[model samples]
Target: MSSRPLEPKDPGLSFGGGARAVLPLTIAVAGFGISYGVLARSAGFPPLAAVVMSATTFAGSAQFASASILEGGGAVASAVTAAVLLNARYGPIGVTVAPVIEGGFWRRFLIAQLVVDESWAIAHRGDGRFDLRRLIGAGLVLYAAWTSSTAVGALGGEFLGDPNVLGLDAAFPALFLALLWPQLRNARAIAAALLGAGIASTLIPVAPPGVPIVAASVACLVGLRR
Candidate 1:
C-alpha cells in the first residue's frame, strides 16, 4: 500500500504550539517586566510613561539600563546611548531571522519589532531555519505578558516598596542566564561567554552602564572566525 503525502502544518496550530513552548520563558519575562515597572517608577517615570516605555521598547535590559541611568541623574542622551548599546544585539538577531520571515514590506517591518532575544531563540529550529508561525506566536504571547505585567507593576509600584527588598532585582539576570545556559554547548560558545564576562566585569567600574555589555558582546565575533 502506498503511503499518503504529508500535509503542511496549520498556521494556527503552529502558532499555538509555539506559544505553549515559550510559555515557561514568558513567566520569567513577566517577572522581569514587573521589576522593570517598579524600577521605572522609582526612576521617576509616571506610571503611564513607564508602561508606555515597556510597550514601545519591549526590551527589558535596555529599559532597565535607561531607567537606572536616568535615576542616577544621567542626561537623557546618556540614557538613550545606554539603551542603544544594550539593544545592539538585536541587529544581529534581526539579520539572522530576516530571511525566514515571510511578508511584504510593512508586514516584515511589524515583525521586526518583535524580534527580541527570546523570540529569536525560540523561532530558531536548530536547523538554520526559522518557524515563522512560532516566531509570531511566541512574540505575541511574550509581548502581552511583558506589557501587561509592566502595567500591573507600575500601577502597584506604590505598594511594592523596594523591588530589591523583594529580590525582584535578580529576576532579569536569572532569566538571561537561564536562556544563555542552553546555548553554550560548544567550546567556541564557552570561550566567547568567558571572554565577554571578563571584559564586562573589568569595564563595569570605569565604563558607562551599557558600554561594557556592548564591548564584551564583540567577543561573539570569535564565533564568526571559526
Candidate 2:
C-alpha cells in the first residue's frame, strides 16, 4: 500500500515565534506611536484620549490622517472620513489571511484586531500563506508598544515639542523598507514592487493622503494574469 504524503509543518506559529520576529522593530513602532501621540496632542486630543485611541484604533496611518484633519480645523465628519479612507487597505489585507485564521465569529473578530501592516508582513509565510500564531504574537507586542508609547508622548507632548526634530517621521518608512526588503525575491516580484512604487510616486502629489497607497496596490493585480 502506498503511504500518504507527509504534511508540511507551518513555518511559524508555536512558541511565540511571531512575537519574537517583530521585536526588532519595537523601537520603530514606539517612535511611530510617539509621533502619533504628539500629533494627536497637537490636534487637541487630551492625553487619556490619545492613549485610548492608540489602544482602540491600532491603525497608524488612519490615526495620523484623522489627527491631521482635526488639526487643520476639519469637521469631525471629515476627520472620520480621512481615517476610514486611510484604513481601507485593510479590507483587502483581511481577506488575504481569512483562511488561515482558526475559530468562529467572536474569535475571528478578536483576531482581526491584530492584523496590522507590521504584524501581517511579519507573519506572512509566502505563497499567500500566513501563520496566525505569529500574527497574533506580533500584534500583541506591537499593540503594547504603541499604546504605551502613545501614553508617553501624549503626557510629554509639551516637552517633546516637534516630532520632526526628533526625526520620528522616518520610523515608519524605514520599518516599511525593512519589511519589504525580504519580499523582493525574483523578477516578477521585483517588477511588481517597482510598478507599485512608480504608481504611488505618481499619485502622491495629485492625490489625497491614502489614495496613493490604495491606488498603487492595484499594480499587484498584475500577478493574476500569470
Candidate 3:
C-alpha cells in the first residue's frame, strides 16, 4: 500500500469571488473617494494628509461630514464630534460579524479594520451569518481603490475645481442608491427606506450636519417589531 501526502485544504471559498462581486461597486467607491479627496483638499487638508485620512479612517460618510464641517469654518472639536457620531453605526455593524471572524487578538483586530459598509454589505450571506473569506477579499481591494483614488483627487483636484461642477458629487448618492436598491425587495424594507429618507430630508433643513443622518437611522428600529 502506498501512502499519499496530505493535501492542502481548499475550503472552496474564493476571496476573489467577493472581490469580483464588489468590483462594480469598487468603481463607484473610487469616484466617491475622489470627491472626498477634492473636498478635503479644498478644506485645507494637504494631499498626503487627505490620503492618510482615507486610508486610515476608511469611513466615507464620516470623512465627508468632517470635511464639510471644516470647510464651513467649523471648529476641529465640532468636526471630530460629527465624525464620531456618523461612525457610531459601526458599533452595531461590528458586533453583527464578530462571531464569524475567528482569530487571535491582533488578527481579529486587523480583520475588524476591514469591515466597512461596502465589504460588510457584500460579505453577508443573508442567513444570519457571514463569509469571512468574502469579507477579507472584498475589504483589501476596496481599501486599495479608496486610498489610491483619494490620492488622485487630492493631488489633481485643483484642476477638477468644485467636484459638483463635474457631477462628482453625484457619486455618493449614486453609490448609496445602488447599495440600497438591492435590499429593497420586501415591503418592510421599502417602507423602512422611505421612512429613513423622509426623516433625513425633513431634518436636513433644521438639524445640524450629522444629526439628520443619525435621526434618520431610527427607522431601522422598525425592523425590530417584526
- lDDT scores for all predictions? 0.77, 0.80, 0.78
Best by lDDT: 2
Q: Estimate each model's TM-score.
A: 0.75, 0.85, 0.75
Model 2, CA-based lDDT: 0.80
Off by over 4 Å in 1: 1-13, 161-226
**Clash count, predicted structure 1:** 0
Clashes of each: 0, 0, 0
lDDT of 1: 0.77
lDDT of 1 by residue, 1-226 (tens): 0011112454433778668767877767777788788888889999999989988889888999999999998999989988988888687678778897876999999988887777766666543457787788889998999999899888884565454565666755665566466556778878888999999999989976666766886787776874
Query: How accurate locally is residue 155 in candidate 3, as Cα lDDT from 0 to 100?
Result: 86
Model 2 quality (TM-score): 0.85
Q: For candidate 1, what is the TM-score?
A: 0.75
Ranking by TM-score: 2, 3, 1
